[model samples]
Target: MLKFNHLFNTLVLLFPIFTYASFNVGFKQINLDKVGSRPLNIAVWYPAKNSGETIAISDNTVFYGSRVIPNGKPLLSNNKYPLIVFSHGYGGSWRNLSWLAYELTGQGYIVVAPNHPGTTILNRDIKQSVQLWQRPRDLSRTIDAISIDEDLASYIDMNKISAIGYSLGGWTVIALAGGRFNTALFKQDCMTHSNLKACELVSDLGLDNPELNNSMKDPRIKAFITLDSGLARGFTPQSLKNMDIPSLVIGAGIDVGDMAVELESGYLQQFLTKSLSTYIVIPDAMHFSFMQVCKVGAVDLLNKESEGEGIICQDGGTRERTEIHRELSYLITGFLSKIFLNTAD
Candidate 1:
């Protein structure tokens, strides 16, 4: 019996162990030709079964990439995961928020992000970028495309959809949540505060078009979160007061140029009276803190490419960017759990 027991123990030790709570991330890219005037390139991240080769996503010399299983099969289960649509900041691409996407997927949520035409780093079309209204439309169309995607739709819970954005992307999600834009108000403010960062892009944003005042809200998005949104001053107080969805507005405490918290995130928090709004300020974080982690010597490399691009790696306080991301992840996950799971911590 002792020999039999020893053999059994050896067998058990040789067998691979698996944790039920842990999940591998899956990634894929697809293009939708009908999304707008240009084809929209989208990146999707989701909980995947441990069955494929792990690879680095969006890896570059300057930024560290997240590991994911390319085209890995979705976890085998009847459960449909919550969907989170991410909108990247101006001049950013779908990979900009990939860190957060991987985190959310690990927590059992599916994330989709689109590289906005003209505005994304991959494709910068001055004419297409100037059409500000098209930004929100890009997200709305992305949601539509995902909803009909046979492979992804089966794993997504459409009813539990949420939107998250950073910088100008934040403004895009806000518009998705029913906030109306007041072009005249924005232009007048720009005239007064000419030094404001958003004002510098007045011509590019096409603020003169009265049609921009029309509502671009998409009812499919149940909730939203914004990080240091730009062009927020253009949203009318009445429109913000009328939005009834739940929202979380996070601002970086460090002021960088005209993109101050007061003019953007603070403005949103102040006027979102009717929504179940929660506001937070990360004291150690800067606007670029929301982006992916930078590689060693990345600052110098970026500076070499462009005169002031190195600021992307700079932060406000002594804490490292990864630390800031951990705090943000905690706050964001906690808030989302309350809304999606209806549980309090």
Candidate 2:
């Protein structure tokens, strides 16, 4: 029994516990009306002081992830923190990336994530999907709202803003970072690589309208981080070459095997000739693994609820979800700090 106890103690020592300051989370729901009557629903998360309550979250009755209760006041910290605008994947809700939001806020960042109205699961308008140009507009609008809003402006450092996106959101950030969309190129690639699932989806959505194009780049965004970017083939080499911002591309290793990583995230890193680009591949991650950690029995429920989309319920083999979040938080926070906060090793 003593020998067993010794072994347990040694293991515990090897896996040292990591902890952070218990800062209360302050949350607010803002309506960005600058973009006309159809105000964008912006979910803001920031550091606060006080207790919070647990609340339920959902995506148009499809999948239900974990609930979060933010505890704190509306007051901003004395220090001016960098702002991170997060764009969610297609048919994904703002709450989908709440886990990452929570982590960033806890580490001294004001994180604002908005749900792209028509593209979110709550709406899912195919016409909205086709007009992919609107995606980046949604993000710019969110940034504008935060800037003018008296409450949000005080907490954020306007000059040190960065953007992070996943899946379709990844494409949005790339566009915001100066990568222009090319529908003709996308079509040609699809014709050549018809077997790619992303191509098949694009063909179904028919996002080939040239009239919807616009200048999506925002000068305020100094850095961009993308994860498992989708439909990246739409950006031509010339458009990407124009990008001068520091960008990071993270992809799921499993996505490479699935044939989804090559066209978007992979393509961006390979073709961005002028930008400072860094790429990292999480060896065992899948496209959906970047979302919130699944709730109890979420896999079974998702399989029973939706077809083909149940892959969202799965994660990399033998890897705990919390561990993935921890690693991501560490890398992301470190990267942002180095560039925006001017904190160097």
Candidate 3:
């Protein structure tokens, strides 16, 4: 529902009142290099022994002051905690999901989020967006890097790696978990539903790449969680049926107006026969509501200066973003905990 501001490279740095949460957030960054692959900027968040200092975290478009213990001692869980990787949507930075990372780490999970080379906020090429297979490969490489990185490997239980993706990221995790995409499926939908936003995007961008059918399945990822999953038209019943891991699909109610609910989450819930998938449609939520909550006054400022770029800042009709985030974090933690720790509420 919102367009990314390409002209402005940055926004005014601001600090809003940050409430102290139940767990202290810690931060770390590392460079990931794979043979024949571009180096990636990876960010990590884990539970820390102390409440850290407030520092500016930039996402190209804006700077957020967050309280984080930089390089602080990670709170030991005795047993290796499960690893959760986060993937952001097209034209988004890894920090877009920082709220979720903080929540996950608080719940005793080590979180890794990497900025995908071409599709991130730093580079906004439509061609890179269509190269859908690369997204999952980016995640696989993160997994590879984590396995060998001495600092990360010791604290993470790589055996229980899971992923949480939003928008195109959802497609990435599905592909990583064995779902295949048939470009023809989307093409057919384009012919019948040309007025839909996704169909219009496919037509405008000419995204008929042959690599859409390739599978980027990574056996290490045991489960996936998706939100307002974009480009799911590429999936057919057979392709979705190939998935064997558990999945949680969260859809925005506002997307039902655009058919994304039906094409993506609903379809997966109805037809992904080989796995148990849980689907939840948040009533009145918008497509961008899945992203992190904006700081106080941030939405109004973006609207006044960025011309409705604040659309991403808005949430479901009058719903407090704080409440939404709290509910979602609880749901994600519970779902992942049940899977990885065998804990049930």
Q: Each model's TM-score, in the order given?
A: 0.91, 0.85, 0.85
Q: Encode model 2's per-residue lDDT on 70-183: one tens digit a residue.
A: 434654556676789999987887887888887787777888888886678787777566667778888898999888777668767888889999888998888887788777
Highest lDDT: which candidate?
1
The clash count of every prediction, one per candidate, is 0, 3, 0
- Candidate 1's displacement at residue 111, Å, is 0.3
User: Which portions of model 3 show Cα errors greater than 4 Å?
Assistant: 1-23, 34-37, 51-65, 203-206, 256-259, 343-345
Task: Tell me, by TM-score, which candidate is best.
Answer: 1
Arrange candidates by lDDT, descending.
Answer: 1, 2, 3
Q: What is the lDDT of candidate 1?
A: 0.84
Candidate-wise lDDT, in order: 0.84, 0.73, 0.73
Clashing pairs in 2: 51-71, 52-71, 53-69
Candidate 3 weakest ten by summed lDDT:
8-17
Q: How far out, in Å, is residue 200 in model 3?
A: 3.4
